[model samples]
Target: MSICILYYKMFMFYSLCLYFLSLYLLNLDFTLYLELNILTLNSISIEMIVYFDWMSLMFMSFVFFISSLIMNYSEEYMMDDKKLKRFIYLMVMFVFSMMLVIMSPNLISILLGWDGLGLVSYILVIYYQNVKSYNAGMLTALSNRVGDAAILMSIAWMFDMGSWSFLNYIDYFLMNKEMIWVASFIILASFTKSAQIPFSSWLPAAMAAPTPVSSLVHSSTLVTAGVYLLFRFSDLFSENFMSFILYISLLTMFMAGLGANFEFDLKKIIALSTLSQLGMMLVIFSLGDKMLAFFHLLIHALFKALLFMCAGFIIHNIMNCQDIRFMGSLISYLPVTCSCFNISNLALCGLPFLSGFYSKDLIAEILSMQFMNFIIYALFFISVGLTVAYSMRLSYYVLLGDFNMMSLNFLKEEKNQMLKSMMILVFLVIFKGSVLIWLMFPTPYFIVMPFYMKIMTLLMIFAGILLGYEFSQIKFYYQNKSLKFYHYSMFFSNMWNMPILSTLGVSPYFLTLGQLYLTKMDYGWMEYYGSKNLFFLVKFSSQLFQSFSHNHLKIFMGIFFFFFFFLILSFF
Candidate 1:
């Protein structure tokens, strides 16, 4: 058998086993430790400490479970590529790094996993070797570098604990006034990784990667890492800090929902949806409900990964075209892909009894009963409504309307390999919600709210259906609606112009600064003071030496001696 096939079978075995393992871990909680001599600073021994508990075990099991499927999926998805082996190697290393992050309770050891994630993900983003891939990879890598730097800054402040394990001495962070800065720094790091607000452009731009990479990145691992970290450290934050996170997360969700509505690219729309979901997880975390956030995180991963795979199949059929405007009636042509896509989309919309409904409905209910201001409540519901609107709008434009492609597109291919992995994920997307709820929260939650508020999600959901359908029915509207001529339309359609802001905002200023430094510091001032002036001095010394060695030795010595005698007389 080929190596990729062998590897696929092994991971499939592991993924099947991990489902049972995740269930078994719920009943037990324990910590296992491993220590290694790392480094010595100021003659003090520093040991890298690793920590694992039920939380870590449960999360690690899911990570492995999902990663196994992603690898298996990529086997066929990347079959034609020359660099398939290299991609697989990076994928495996990426999984290992995520495992490290999940298992380590110490900030010190987690840094290894953390940095590995940034570096490997950067490499993966640029895997295609195109200008678009290069730009996307740089945007991805630089944005994440900010978070890596923040982690280092937090580690420096953590020196007071004398150890890298924050779980061992969480009180040090909670007690010190200065340690609040550490928490602040950690929050900033999470923002960069999770693509919150100003860091939002990279998430959509990252659609330049292949489909399997998008599935792995947007769903279980890379983007979710920030929420997992912040959720792990949620206990260390003050209420004010919690409030700061709350507002920002809401804004991120709001921004992403708005962006998705205006977006036409299929992959980018899905990427924006992931961003919106990350914001939702952060909301629950900010509310001091880590378990609920985790529940949402797991559920979101299952459906979103499935959604990306389904989209991949469609893109594969459409000759790699991603613009939704060119797609319609795919339901008739690609039934299996359309079914998977619709199921995942419905789950995302929180259609009752699906995976997302269980976790997302609970979150909205819980938020309704909490002591929140009107704007927060409104933003939460508005974001939720936007999710449904965009989902329906995407479906209408891509599945229900007339075919919009300009040429005869052939789509006779049967996607056996991609569909095989998706079937496994489809089962999870359908049922993982109730399974996780049974394991994580054995006791049912009782929510107290007004009847109208209780059904608000249902109301918004139906409203979205109406608006999305109405908007899509007008064929001439889209044909005549000039997004370019309409300036505000262009602004939002272009992802709030964040790509321009981030690229132009940083690149031009630095390019100008670099120009000045190259001219004045490196070429001009440093040349004169460092090389040019030294060259002249050396040349004059060489001339004097040559004169002394030839006919001018006596004159040279007389002048030198006279100057020495004058200096001696002045001192006397």
Candidate 2:
């Protein structure tokens, strides 16, 4: 009857159907491929291909389920906005693009979806129509464009192969060293899309977007696209390339987790947490466990989406104040939302039996199983500690501290739609980890390790909690310690100056180069010899022709008179 009901029923139906389909496919070990031949020219058949394996189906199911919840949440969250229909349209378009990415195995089709994601995300990032939004949108678009360019190059390289279906040529990409460039391009594309290291600044910057968009795009779908693409192409990566990814992802994880501890903005803190988790996914993926990465991706999406939703509700209730410093005793004001937030936060910290623990603990144990250098091993555990520290720090500031906002602030949770969505995710956050592990890994992994090594993860978690509490408790009335060590705090908080490097640090050089080109070539030599000289030469030649033509008749008469004069003079 109503649009909301219709939307809910439609997405719910699709999600259920796809979930069932995925389970069936998984059970049967079957894959379904459908190709629609659009045209054929020069023996090259241009066709659109859809590959329906269990992985794609399961991922799509998650996407649909999340989209449905986010849209429902948006109905309440974005209800006050004038252009609600436009927001809905953009959201649907975003979801459709994600579906295209998940379903298609063809590089050309994947590019179509990838570009769609970039363009739509840019529009969404700038939706607020402000200077900050504009800057953030530009940063997001430009960063992702690097990945898009890589994908385009990969497509060109793949052209040497008859068809653009990368699925059919996974082993070919792996075995052939000549096609290694294509694999490199694909990895590059994933790094940018996933916001690894240098490209990571945009993830937090993109918090300029609406919270709903951030929840949908940053938490679950957009950031994960690169991971999904890499997941599909995991078989193609060489050992060296995987090692390189491993290090970069580990660094990204550490950087994001560390930065979140220092970040003040609530949404940016969450955004940083998303970045940290993404790094974890990539770390696992690069460590030669593709399914483990996907498992984490799915579980992370569920809790992270819930986390963002809880955050949005909190932000809404608190009169749009995002600084956690100004937010305290939120548990007293919005109990349900705060409770949900705590649950999701704990899930993020990989508290036992929660959604994150299923994937994160497994990833840690598996990593320990692998033979890695001491540095890599140490960084991984430290990053894990940082994750807990930030989560605890955020909780202390938001849920436990004294109320700092205005006394008259009417902070109360929305009753109907927003709570409904959060409740659903809370259930998933608590129980879905076990269900997914059981379903996905019918036969569990046999991981063997010493007792001390096994308990290292828990030790890090406890240490992180203590450190986080201590950091929050520290106070000096005269000056903040962070200000005393301003340089280091700024460096760590600013994602190791990646934001500067990506924006101001690199842009000025390019601007300077362009200026040099403009002066030396466009204004100086090219102006003198190319355009300016050519203009003057053309003008002079045109003037000479015009004068000659106009005087031609007069000259003929003058010549006759001169000849008569000359003949008379000769006769005399």
Candidate 3:
């Protein structure tokens, strides 16, 4: 109870602070950097650095606000759990870790937060004490370890610069060719942390966590950590490196959007949407509009967290049923939750006047303006259509379809803490976009484009709604299309075989390498020429000494006779 109160206070405090800080920063047009040196070693300063700017403050505000809501929601959602206190403590630690990442500009400090997030999130993922949770936690931790290693490499690579504060040296990257390696390492770290492309399997697997933990991890703390890191280092990235990020992010966007449509699990669908939005943010950031990406990140956090909370409410009421196929006509029972869910879902699809629209629409327009190939244009729009299509499909299966759950199910609106938290977000989901666009962009953006190009967003959205309803239609007379192409659908539904590639496809080589090292290096040569030979040599020497001690009398008589014989021979 005390913790809940504290979080609520912190949320209010951060929101107030963010408003004033944004006003001050916008008016002053300045940034504050503070470094407290702990020690200087070999001309390199080991220090704690904090960067105060509008961006970091804004991010912190969003994180704190969302975390507070999740915490409050957890009070009800996790009421029956045994270790609720431990869960609360872990949640607090998770938020603190994210705070460290947001405020620190130094690579070393950022890594402290980066590693903290990875470790805490792993614990959270496996909170259920099940085999599935354990596997999911392992996947989350191991995947994040790749990013952690990248950060370590970046730190070592930056050793020659005599400073671990990469933010201070962004301009000097061009002066030294080796600094690009540092950028590459940071980008790699961001990729694994953000779960981009090859690293994406962990995000959905992480749904094994409690819904509250999922709300925090998927929405703000874990997945966004990667995007936030790269947002800070955007200036250091070269065109070639950014192109790589662009293509990877584009594919992630399309793949996630496609995957969400096929996914039946409620939380996994939300997780995939988060991935798609992350790709959208990265796509814009790679195109050299980081502030736009940050804008979307802040907005996405609000709705995504709320979406998870709504899903959690439904799952809780339905006795832990997560399959949307078994959950139809939720609107009849959970009108408030259904309303919030649809609003956020449309916001995700960039419905005009919602928070997501202000950033997503701008991203589409800016992307269209970019000089790119036909493939890029097609994927971007198709991904957008997929986003809306999946969202609509989800709404159909979960809200508008026939009731498929057992007759004993009694679902209703959670009217206390859970509803309060979600209602707050519902307000933000509606107005925050317009509010942020006005504050962030004082002068309205002038977009000059043809009529057809202008209507492309609406066109795709309308088409997606139609396609989603068509896909959701259940005609018993017709053979199931998905089962007809079972193998192909499975591939798409399984994140294009990413989970298998990450787990089954990759684990064998690592296991084989470990076995080889154990046999050839650790247990074989080291055993023979190292420990085993030394043991035998010591044993033989000790035995010889023991034999000599046993024959001491005979050895002494032999030595005397040999001396006498030598004297006699000399006399002769």
Q: How many pairs of residues collide in model 2?
A: 0
lDDT of 1 by residue, 15-130 (tens): 55655655665566445678787886774447776665556666766777667777777877788898888888898888788878877767766788888989998898888889
Per-residue C-alpha lDDT of model 3 across residues 274-363, encoded as one tens digit per residue: 999999999999899888898899899989998999899999999998988888888989999999999999899999988899999999
- Assess candidate 1 and give its TM-score to the true structure: 0.90
Per residue, candidate 2 scores C-alpha lDDT tens digits across 422-505 of 998899899989998998999999999999999999999999999788766752321564465656767889999999989998
What's model 1's overall lDDT? 0.84
For candidate 3, which ten residues in a row score worst on lDDT?
474-483
Best model number under lDDT: 2
> What is the C-alpha local distance difference test score of each model?
0.84, 0.90, 0.89
User: What are the clashing pairs of model 1?
Assistant: none
**Ranking of predictions according to TM-score:** 2, 3, 1
How far is 184's C-alpha from truth in model 2 (Å)? Answer: 0.4
